[model samples]
Target: MPCIGVPCTKSLVRSNKHHLTVSFFQATQKLPSVLLAAYAELDCGGLDLLQGELPQSIANELAATAKAIAAPGKGILAADESTGTIQKRFDSIKLQNDEANRAAYRDLLFSTEGLGQFISGCILFEETLFQKNQDGVLMVDLLKKQGIIPGIKVDKGLETIPRTDDEKATMGLDGLAERCQKYYAAGARFAKWRAVLSIDPSQGKPSDRSIAEVAYGLARYAAICQQNRLVPIVEPEILTDGTHDIATCAQVTEKVLAAVFKQLSDQGVMLEGALLKPNMVTPGSECPTKAKPEEIAFYTIRSLARTVPPALPGITFLSGGQSEEEASANLNAMNKMGPHPWALTFSYGRALQASTLQAWSGNAENKAKAQAALLKRAKANSEAQLGTYAGGAGGGGAAVSLFEKHYVY
Candidate 1:
């Protein structure tokens, strides 16, 4: 009989029981040196946990940092949009996408009065990592002065997968360890790598190939980040595209997460030293039925409870397509329901900045207004983190879902 579609090699199995072993000389004579070297490097991360462990001091620090980022009533501000993406956003408001403009915008956000009360961290793009405010203080220093942790976005961006209509795999794993070391030395203590996936039942989108690719890439990314003393925020966003229902979204999210954890364990990743940035469970953008905040909370928490281990310190949700108020409402609902194992909070991008960006519109005179707008959104998210956000945190584009079809960055 055949097993697993391969002929059962009973003779080889029986031969293995004979305890016959080849000498090093015979082994080397049969296999070339290059082949042996190739076999060894095939597994990039030598996760020999049974033989050794990462330094305890490093582990402790990573865990402490993870906890601090998800501390009570605090959430992360994801201002890490790439240059092209920022250009698109600026275009929306008829602003020039100049370097100085970007610098000023980030400066306004980081220098917001009392922002640290709500935002514990700010994820920055490569450009903002080294930029300074007009006063000449490093942005990283600015954030640190306000008790905010500075994190870097390490992934280059997404690339289309071959043979797929529109599935993407995250790039920038090459030289990641070196980049993490540089970022860490420059005062960043955490990093993010975002991998995007989409759902389209008609086209059979989000194939198993895509999920597996994401899992493998993320695991490698996490290991490299930790080796360089930075906590990794593993963001595998299941995009809210198509016309799928909430149940479909939940199912795909669960499947992706299950594969992610498995890959993490296989690579010997320290669970306590990481944070998961995932999308909240919600209906697709084109779906007719809308889910209430409570329903969204139920499915989101259930999915995490099933796939995420208790060892993880936090699960910060990404507001991919939700409006500012909608995102706050959902986060508040989740916290209300979750005396959950891991801390649940927000790491939002557009949802947190849409109103602020609209308020700024590239005007230097509007800096104070921009800062105020940003602070208001941050406070709302902070309230949501604690399950106390009241009803009104509106944005001008409340009805427009931030769901760009095949959105890059």
Candidate 2:
């Protein structure tokens, strides 16, 4: 007898082979109309197999990927800021700022063994995305081989607002969605867009224009990311340029985050697949009295919890010019203060890179020393993620001397 299953030979052949098929018309016609009606009345909407489109297994894979990236006691390493920013950092350490040096520096970080122990993802700038290591391995491929998700920073640098001479706005909306598609094709599983805001008390509270602009910008960028299947790190930073106290900073941060989340919701963003990179609440550079690391952590967390929705995958605090030890200490304290609604961790740049550059000093022989320094800071911050940081107690008091008055840009 010929096979009657859906995969039978008759089904696989063209029209001429149909004579070999056995007809089921008699059986089909024997079914009662009432039985067919009852079958039609069954609500398959609740059935796993007939539910809206996405299969359960694929959905579960997406959820697992997001969880791994935003897992507690682990945070992303943002090596993604632009070459100019990295160059400025290298300049501070009196090192040569060239393409090869930059690649070497990044390679030093990526080459670290056991980095996956704490770092869940590494965000790369565009230049780093296409660069290869000395051994001829693509950086993105190398990262994925170690089980780390490779991400890309999508926004072009901030530009000066045309009419508002004092204010700056982030550009790159031009062709951004297409760019996101390209990045996704190039092995980026996530993308970042940073929007800058300044706190100008003299000019009054955050202007409606600035708030609306940033919120809309982030929401659009996030929507594009979702369409391309990339998780977005939405960062709307209220820069620490004023002399405001921690309380004022907290209030502004709350307002900014509230607006951001509202816009994200309005844009139908999937919060579960997104991460937030926000500035920790702290006194400004010109503020005479600086808060301790503990104070900073408490205020930052409290403010975030009040504004950021619980649905977000995670909240990664930006170091925002905090010293390495200070950033680590603050992160440790935040984790220590009881429970938080979301994973509290670091997306630091300068804080993580400063010591490494200082140790490297542009010398080939010092590569080991530089790598050791990078690993030490990475491990320290990793421990901080778990509230166990203990590296620089009583070494230097928390201070804001890093910023000079009318600091040269």
TM per candidate:
0.86, 0.81
- Per-model CA lDDT versus the true structure: 0.82, 0.72
Best candidate per lDDT, number?
Answer: 1
- In Å, residue 215's CA in model 2 sits off its true spot by 1.0
List RMSD in Å for every model shown.
Answer: 13.3, 17.3
lDDT of 2 by residue, 1-409 (tens): 3322234454443221223222221222223233324434666522113223333343333344566777766777888857667767777778777888888888877877777777788899999988898888888887787677888999887766655635656678889878888898888888888887877788874676777788889988987777666778899887777889999998989888889889988887766567888989999877899898778876786677568765565778877777778888889987776344466788876666666676777787888877777677777888888888876632342322344242212
Scored by Cα lDDT, where does model 2 land? 0.72
The candidate 2 region of ten consecutive residues with least summed lDDT is 21-30
- Residue 259, candidate 1: Cα error in Å is 0.2
Clashing pairs in 2: none
What is the Å distance of residue 69 in model 2 from its true position? Answer: 1.8
Candidate 2 lands at a TM-score of 0.81
Query: What lDDT does candidate 2 reach at residue 383?
Result: 85
